[model samples]
Target: MWGYMRPIKKAVFPVAGLGTRFLPATKVVPKELLAIIDRPLLQYAVDEAIEAGIEQFIFVTGRGKGAIEDYFDMAFELETTQIGRGKDISALHGTRMQPGQAVFLRQQEPLGLGHAIWCARHIVGDEPFAVLLPDEFMYGSPGCLAQMVAAYERLGGNLLCTLEIPIDQTSSYGVVDPGERHGAVVEIKGLVEKPAPGTAPSNLILPGRYILQPEIMQVLGRQEKGAGGEIQLTDAMAALIGSQPFNGLTFAGQRFDCGSKAGFIEANLALALDREDIGDHILAYAADLIATIQKGRGLSRDVA
Candidate 1:
């Protein structure tokens, strides 16, 4: 049983951002290398892509992102040490990518998401590809990208994993002008990148995961800067709205915006609290912390 849509074989990870939000830590280490539980953020995104049947991994990186390249490569000395010590090497399995399976392209300038994706055009080569942003760490049963792939199989068009945000918060996200809703999938009438608060078309926002057709590359090639002074992917995607079968799939998952400091901490705690090895302990500590805070607030109220 083959689907009419070309199989999504490649996934693009735009890891070129300088991560200014992460500050000093990011100054030394690329933000994508930051960990949630035991896995680096990028690993989580890559794992999601792999789970979604993605074969080729395209990493659009910039200077100072060498660590990401090394992280995916085989660590010979570490593997040798683990072998000599007879330690379980299961942890190393995910880090190693098969030869020719991974390719890294340099995004020479600090452009934007659109330019970062455009950099992968040559390798993508007329195939429908997936774009997974590592900063948006999603925790779901089958993974967010897997869910989107399932939708893509049924819908067979450009699909953006979407979530309904408060109307006021729509200014922070790429707001979707929705047309019709067919269960979880919604027809995208238009896409507005960070629309002004009261002017947003809808409350639904594109969170990060996307299944885009190759024609978007052509749209982005001559695309002008939008929202910010950089070439925004939202603008390029918006240009293809009426021309293509554009839709939004509202995925069932908890998306953590690891790009922000608060969100990063929240992701770590949330994932950690779900782990078998440390869930109980973390839960207990959290309970105690909440109690202490509540007690302090009570005392303050009594004094007042």
Candidate 2:
């Protein structure tokens, strides 16, 4: 139909995880508040939503996540200091939201993504809403959320971002059983979360970008625990497979798995190398670093 059933004006970011992978630092700072270059993880997710024409940002947070809210509010003391020092604060441009555009709700327990999303039900109301996982960073043309939105307009119903991974690695993500392919989008027949290794129907994995109908939220209310004895979003999504038009978009762009230490470093390197301001410098430095590392390995081999 080439049009969305309803305008997607709001996006939900589930940022309540303990982020134990990045402990110590995360103990003081929420993982979603961690920066990718100069912007926080949550900020990139928000910016992606903005590109998709989203007007509201709803955060499902837990304990020790107050900093996320503060980051969006005015800091009179900091602004005053910057003004007095004649220091430019333009970096903060587009960072603050107009009143009522941002909302934060506490997800009282560490249930699961489905539970966290259910916490924002009242705010989400009865329209389709987006769910973005801040830790899954994606940099793509049209942006991840925008691409999913575009596909939603054409297909209508449930749609999410998908990337093909090695088959054996499918156990690490929710696997989609594809029924048909249309260009970069795959029609979804079903979804299995973290299937046993070698048992996944397909390698395409869901990486935290979704346009789900309001019905899924109703399914989640049942709170049935799936894989990890938690209210799994995959289980709820599975219930809506044939009832509506559902599919996945193979978004075009570089994606970074910022959920781990290695992925985070890789994302930093890849993104830095693509930046106009730092590309050349980082390229030269990386080249030199690789050369030196290779030389050291050669010398060690000769000694052996």
Candidate 3:
């Protein structure tokens, strides 16, 4: 750990993933641009970072992701059209970035999360920085990053957005070896990425939001390919166990793995159903749809 800590002012977004799960839709549009109700998945993550006091954004982008860059730039024509229609463009306010606030870099290879984060090392410099994965959609107040930043301030070390998953699901995440806990904060002694069934140390796992020391970028620099022949961020983080202050914060929020189609649909439905403007409407529609499906199943049984 540094003798004096620097407040996290920068955040890195690793958006280089191929998003293979979304397929043909992702072929032309980045899955990050896919709207949740109305706001794109990427917008939510950026908003979360901003709420956490982030001043600069480092987006580690991949090939064919220019649309993301364009999205943040001034949309002159759109602004003019909205003005002409006398529409309040307040919804578009948070999407604007000040000069030098955002820097996008290319991840030349399809390496793992570790490598993608490593790509932003230069922009991140030597301060503590945040990493937000847009694919992991977080819902609720204070946001995921804001909660982690608060925990990091109290603990003064690296902190991850942690969750206690079912034992069978341990293989799908970076499982943590628990050491202690206070409220939503958990002290972690070890981390294992995607452990096999029955081999994980604990069900608690990292869930794509992090406040990491700059030293981790160096750890990632030397990290070899782990589980999937790609540099795993968990590998570098696990190496920091004994050398630095580390803990996990079980964030207060609902999370969705928007990388998957099911999760994407679920996020939209959940958010829509919670909206004051549309909640009751959607609830009735959903109930009616379920009734229709059940009645159709009953008709099929009668025919059989």
Candidate 4:
């Protein structure tokens, strides 16, 4: 049914969203640059893609995103200054993309995720490409996309990273109508973009990761405004189901929706507690803070 999936060398990151949630902070720094522990959100996504064998990075950016481009480009003066000062240069190694491997496209309009993705269609060409939203950070053993890539090797047409969410919360995500289940992989019978509560087909929500065929670009091209009158990537994906082999990969990982304030803080705290350099200290500090808050509220000391 499937062979060892071809190595995915190209990844498309749609990062043109207006980070309205973060407000003033995002006014200067791109939301993708928000730090999760030590590295930026975009950097984590890039690292994961690299680990999954992605070599070419295609960033679909919008206005005021020059910082993102600069983040990946060589900082010649800074590197030279550090070298002259005898500072370690190793930290600068992972920040660069090899020649011809990084491409950027400007999404002139604040249309939608589908529009942002479509902006990179020419760069993606006809190869199978991976789409990662920097806002959704996944923590796992093998990396979320790597797991989906592994599944794609066997059944390759369009593969989505799916996770089970509370049925009551299905309206908040692109819900999947599952056909058949095989281990962690489910054949996608249909996909509905943020279906109304109780009207959702299934609780299998489409997170921010995708392994799609280039044909999706065509589907997106003719995509009519759905839901919020924006060209949704889910709608385009749904259009590809009958004509292609689309499956949902129930990934083994913890995903953080960094786009939301609560999810962002959770990701920071979770990753902070996993850091060897500061884990124990931060945990202790957090415990002390909780104790203080509890004492102030005249609550029980055995809260934990």
Give the 10-residue window scoring lowest on summed lDDT in candidate 1: 295-304
TM-score of model 4 vs. true structure: 0.95
Of 2 and 3, the candidate ranking higher by lDDT? 3
Q: After superposition, how far is residue 234 of candidate 1 from its true place, in Å?
A: 1.1
Compose the digit string of candidate 2's lDDT tens values, residues 88-198. Answer: 998887678899999999999999989999999999999889999989999977899998888788788888888999998899889899988989998889999999988
2 versus 4: better lDDT goes to? 4
Q: Which residue pairs show backbone clashes in model 1?
A: none
Report the number of backbone clashes for model 2.
Answer: 0
Query: In model 4, how large is the Cα lDDT of residue 242?
Result: 84
* Candidate 3 clash figure, as a count: 0
Q: Each candidate: what lDDT?
A: 0.91, 0.89, 0.90, 0.90
Model 2 lowest lDDT segment of ten? 295-304
Q: Which ten residues in a row have the lowest lDDT in candidate 3?
A: 295-304
At residue 61, candidate 3 shows an lDDT of 95
TM for every model, in the order presented, reads: 0.95, 0.95, 0.95, 0.95
Cα lDDT tens digits, model 3, 108-202, are 99889999999998888888899999999999898999988887777888888898778998898999998988888888899999999999998
Candidate closer to the true structure by lDDT (higher is better), 1 or 4: 1
Clashing pairs in 3: none
lDDT of 1 by residue, 40-96 (tens): 999999999999999999999999999999999999999999999999999889999
| Best candidate according to lDDT | 1
